[model samples]
Target: MPIKLHDFQQEVVNKFFKSGSLLCVLPTGTGKTVVALEIIRRLKEQYGNKTKCLIVVPANLRSNFVDTIRKFQLKLNAEIIQKVSQLDQAYRTKTILVISYDFMRLYALKLLRYKWTLIVADEVHYAKNRQTKNFAVLYQLRLNSRHFLGLTASPIANTPEEFFTILIIVTGDRSIFAEGMQLIKYMEIGRKDPTWWEKLKATLTGRRPRSKKGELIPIGIKDIEAFRRLVGRWVYIPHYSKIEKLGTRPKVKSFVVRVDLDDFETKAYKYALRKIPRQDLKDLKEGTITNARLRQIKNIIMACQQTLLSPDYIYEYEERGQEGVEQSNISLFRPGSKIKAVAKFLKQTGEKTIVFSSFLRFGARLANHYFNKLGIKSREYSGAVKPQERKEIIKQFEEGDLQVICLTGAGQEGMNLPSCKNVFFLNLPWHGEILRQVVGRALRITSKNPFVRMFWLFAYTKDGQETIDLWLSNLIKRKDIIRNAIFAALQETTANVSVQLPSYEGPRPKSKRKPDTVLGINYPR
Candidate 1:
């Protein structure tokens, strides 16, 4: 059977009915592609049979779309392929061609030759940056071109001006939401209307026709009209609750594992810390430091952190803009107590686990050594891994073929590994966005009772204490420090943007800390 449009999708298609361009904001895994497919069908029939469509998505998602097309049996009526090169080679006319944003950037002039009847950009948030090459290429290709569409789960911007730019591109009207309808306000509107809320639920989900077409719940026309007026005919469906349909999440317990740094590690960390300019550190807190200096400080901190884990990671960047060579091959090797600690924990539990490091070389080294010596199957994933192979490795890990999967930043976002109930953090990222994404990977929802055991291996400062143990706590502190420092440094009249960090509440075990810190978060089962 051909993929039929759900009521939510149908409503969107009806809104864009004869319109040439649209910006749809639906959640991920919600079949935005189906909406795109429906729009394509409607355009071909109403606009003209000769009208063609182009789709741009992240490189990793290209194959997923190809699979989605075949799985939905869209081949009968839709002209969809995996990549642009395939279509370019054929020189055959296909109504729809799917390509990556990278491809679009590299071959912008060549692709601009085609008068695209419609262009759909999936994960449209990539275009939020007006200065990006992707943004530049997309703008050129869609110049004066009608029938362009953009899609994203979240359309967020740090500043109002940035948000306005997105609004103009999406609505094609500078006056859109001119009454100061903030994007945050639009996100909150769904909770106030039940009918719209239902459509939102349907839009975020990818479930099949659980209810018959006649029995399907319908959203109110008046509500839709009101939303249209507010956000300008653009579909802005934000999840009222991120995991509402996931039922219940497993218990998340956080326990800190403090390891004493050896003599070599202590000397290395102290040396690095001493070399860092105290004024730069002060500037970081005062928000007076340049971005370059802030990054340099961050790199120093990260290197010291790595040294605590494995002293072999310490590298001195020469003034020549390259790393200094070591005296001997053995000089680069060290007794990695941190790696030993992780392996000990894994050996004791002997269950499915995910080990995360911030660097690919370290993660790969750890994974390779563990598997080689212990004869335990494992794999490492990072930007270095082939896109196709990453999927296969994740599949194998999920299927229990691999006992563990060591990963860098790649594991942080939107990858499902619910089967692994245990997570070991070998290194922590300073960015809250990254830290949250990593911890979230091991989280899985199930009807039955499920528990997640999270372990954080951290080293102490000169005073022998970890300033921040919890990622959320550290994030909150970091925000306060930076905002205050920036405000103080600039002494500008501009108001500070309020911070809104996600907070989840659930049952909590008794804590010896302060009462407020006991807010039932990170379910400890």
Candidate 2:
């Protein structure tokens, strides 16, 4: 049986072959991996034994690529290089080598000795920070490979800097955008009005610097029209909405479940906030906290956020029990309202659900509550578990052995969870793109559900006092506004039919709402 690709995916493959390097921005669950695999098959057929590919993914996602290969019956020789010792044999024989970002960083120099015909960075945005070893190694790898592919659903998460870093790695041109703000000047909206750029910067950063004289008037849309025109040559975005072959993805109904904190929670949250130095809070308001002070402020904010989740987390319980498993006797501490709300909702829904939480301990507590308290089969999926155990946990969830899987940030990206159609967020992620990635795990093309349900748990005090939940949610909303405007520019770009290969020259680079019903559940006031 031959592998068939959607028309848009075929277009992505065409772009990659013509340009030799591409930043593929396909929406999640739309088969980005299939496209990459198709490319590899062609490479193998064209180049044969000479075809060597390097796939860099987050540690947890390495297995996903390997599994897809087997599932599709693509008898490709793929190897997972765990330690430096195994690299020599794999480098010599394995046509496809899947290495995690962390392992690649650790053994970059040694791995660099081998030549790769193609390199694919899965979830490449992990290298957004130029200072980290992630970016450094990826840049070197891209330079070594004859063809490079950067795969990510959301290219510009929060700021242009992320896209800029990826641009540098893909093109090896560091001077194109100098800084992220330079990329913004090319936007048509800002080019027509320089003040628009400044306002945008201020709004995105929550800091307003005095407008300076002699600002660079954007050369013109011809110089580079926003992000799309600038990186137009090297980037190909096949959005899910535009894919006719997909017919229509399962509709996702999102709701914000407001959980009211009980008296104990309210008092604990207020006390934690009050314990923070008044001066630090003032600095936060003024947006003048030093980097050191910023860390302290984050710690305080984290403490208060934990206060809403569980008292066990607030007390700093070990993420895993003494037996090296995530199971914990959460009964020791009174479960918080948020936990009760999540458990109750899962009980009522009685479906496979993935509950995402930032805190590892909170994830453990939720899993414990589901099984021990509610008699619902559950397990904790986090980095704390061994790779094999994580695989088994996912299997159990898929096979109906587990009713719910409490996942941490580790499993947010690249993990396919089409088995589950319900996603619950214990709290909001720092970036909007992460929120999308987590939701994408359940929105698979193979899903049987007619629609997916996503719920975000937000805690508030009855007295109308603003909690950190409200603050974070509002912040994400504002960031989403900026993210939407930037990516929306890509929609305006006219696709080029002529296949002109790109040179390593320079850089470049919202929703209506129906009132969702609040979960009508009673909590002790």
Candidate 3:
């Protein structure tokens, strides 16, 4: 059967075909690749087989793209090339070239020798960083390619400056920055007083402020009235109530073990904090100093002290052990007291569970502990796992051979794991997107489950809560924006339709200069 395109996918293709370059934003699992493939198909049909297309993606995802293309059986010939030298041979054929972002810098000059008809940038937000070598290469490619397209799910930036840079890359217009600034100014003014635009236009142009009688004049008010009717209105209502029928909920019991810092661990943490910033140390370095400079001194002192003291001073000594003591004490695999609690819960509940950790070592340790000590079935997938092995682990998880799936963020992306409804965050991911992906494993649309429970194991401290809050805020904002946009579109469809006729009936003339005003404008700072 031929591949089918969703309404959103079709819309994306239509927009791209109409415009030379576009930034296509859609949520994950929305089949962005289908939209991209449709564009490729249409371009090939229109321009013939000689046309070339280049797809840039993250290094880890290169295999995933290749698999997708093959599974779909797209007619377009595609090659996955990582080296610059390979491009010379690959460019001879009318084929789509998929490459990693890292390889772009190494082979940019070589690849630029050939002329590409179209270039598609996947995860295009990364190309906005002007300082990166890959970004520069991509920027030059944008100017050289006949057509350009950018695809991303998360396009919102923390600041307007970053957003503008992305827009410029997608649209190839420096003026987009100025337009964005103008829109921001208007939005700020409108927030303070909704009628600020009328006042500003009147003040700046020395025109009479329109009264209720003048409102019917239809020059300025016509457009405003039309827009108001088109966009409709949105309002929020707050409600508070006490629950009469309280429900019992399953509780995720957790235990925190206070592992006293040994002499070596204390010194290592101090050294790690001093040598590098405290923020740089990940969970893996919790009780160990991995810094090269401090390791030798730390090892020598630890070997001399036969019985290391807790919170003891670590000074210089002779006759230290060859191996570092810090490495020994930092047990990434230690079951701790929490292991028994987790194992007992699993056996009693008989519910499939997912355990996540920031450090792969910790995940491995937990998986091993459950398997060896508790005789529970478990499997681990992380960056260290070979591609083939990772696939096999996923297969096992889906087949019910594994009761617990222990993994890091690397395994979370593009993988479907719906057997489990209970998810445990052994450690939190820094990015909100990663967290979403991890939890998404339990949220398969086809599953019969009524609800899924996600357990976040955060330390009972201000810093941990702050991090969780930041991630929560970002998630809420993203959800709200998408919800509002969809609601607005639905409202527009339900409202009365109005059409305006052009003043002139002759064929529309093309202008040499750019349009005076775009839909959204921002004044430059």
Candidate 4:
């Protein structure tokens, strides 16, 4: 039996057929794998059993792709080879070989020697980085393969140079540089005030460019309308409020105990300040101390020091009788401190929750506080975990043995965690794509839960609030676009209906009780 294809899959396969070397940019869950399979089938038909196909995927997702292929039961012989030594003479007989990015470098020379009919690159966005060893190997394979296919949810790189690297892999042409440069130049001319010289550099290096509308457009392969439609369907449940409404809210409370930094933090701050040359400060413009500027090591240490020592210098309240005596040195964590508050609330309500932090160290510290100090069962997934161990940890969580899982964004993309009802963003991801993917883990429709609750922990700081606001605003805009697109598609389909007239022609019926006063008005009684 032939494999069935989704609309998007069919479209991608058709493009692959038309363009021997094609780069496919589809959204997640859009059946990129299915398209690749179809391409393999088509190639086998054209070249018979002589054709060999190589599929490259991210290191973390190597097993996931292997499992998918096994489930599909395709005719092609597929093996997930992790090491170069494993790709001996016996492995060469297989039609499709799946290798992780890390192993690509070791086997590139040998792999390139073979007559690979098709080279399918999964997560093809990584190919844009020419400096990477995997990318260099893949580029050589692109030259060797009769046909090349690049697959990614979002293949658009941060710069035009990266974008052309992907294009070069697909088409083996340097001319895309000229096209991208032209677009960038056009964009610079159209804009009244360009934000950064980097933008111009991006155009020259294939980093950034203007859309046809002359707007600064990021590199993205996804159909905007499709992404919007998918996101709009995301069911956001206000679990915290819902439980409160049911009168079974979590009872555990959080207390923010502020400690005065005993000289260490103050010294660190002073050292940081001294490191910044006086000339740099003299040249600095007002309002230049934004998060981007403050991200420097010195500035960050200074800020940390200041925050640590704040409790000692900044008093909450002063008594009239004793001027030096402080009324309250510590402030209680309120409902607004979403991270701790949510954790506390979940503990009270007796629900399993997942807390995501951008920094592994911060996540581990938070987990230790909850598990070690508070005795709340919590496990962490971070960069520290070995690949083999990460799988085992995931298994433990999925089996309901764990109460709370504090993880960085490592497990967001491909890992399945249907048991988690609540997802708290302890720290927001910088990119919108990452944020969406992280939230998506909990929103899987196949889960037993009805709705997923997402809590974004935004600090009272302007930057934190602005990040949350921007995310919300973008979500709303995308939702509207999706809703409109769905409606428009429906209307267009309805409008295209052709009606056949009966043989007998009669005068159009007129009465219908004067159309039952179609227009209603506010009438004075």
The parts of candidate 2 lying over 4 Å away from their true place are 185-226, 243-245, 277-296, 311-330, 363-367, 491-525
lDDT of 3 by residue, 339-439 (tens): 34455556666567777765443344444455545677877777777878877877787775677877776766556665666666544343344555566
Ranking by lDDT: 2, 1, 4, 3
- On the 0 to 100 scale, the lDDT of residue 385 in model 4 is 76
Q: What is the clash count of model 3? A: 9
Overall lDDT per candidate, in order of appearance: 0.54, 0.68, 0.49, 0.50
Candidate 1 lDDT over residue span 272-339, tens digit each: 55555776544433323433444566766655555665565554332212133223233244535556
Model with the higher TM-score, candidate 1 or 4: 1
Whole-structure CA lDDT of model 1: 0.54
Candidate 3, pairs of clashing residues: 179-521, 179-522, 180-522, 181-522, 181-523, 182-522, 182-523, 183-521, 183-522
In terms of lDDT, the poorest run of 10 residues in model 3 is 235-244
Give the worst 10-residue stretch by lDDT in candidate 1: 183-192
TM-scores of all candidate predictions against the true structure: 0.66, 0.81, 0.59, 0.62
- In candidate 2, position 130 carries an lDDT of 88
Question: Against the correct fold, how does model 4 do in TM-score?
Answer: 0.62
Query: By TM-score, who's the top model here?
Result: 2
Residue 454 of model 2 has an lDDT of 76
Give the poorly placed runs of model 4, Cα more than 4 Å off.
185-339, 348-352, 368-375, 399-403, 418-420, 443-451, 461-525
User: What would the per-residue lDDT of candidate 2 be over residues 1-525, giving only the tens digit for each residue?
Assistant: 346987788888898888888888776788888888888888889899999999999887888778889999996899988888988888788889999999999998997998889999999999988899999999998888888888987776655667768878877678644633545532222122434434532222212232222122121122235456567767787543465347545657666666777787787777777767886664443323333444557767776777677654544423442343235554555767877887887778678888888877655455455455678788887777898898788788887568888888777776667778778777766666777777777777777777777777667776755566655664454345445544545652322111111111111111244433434443211
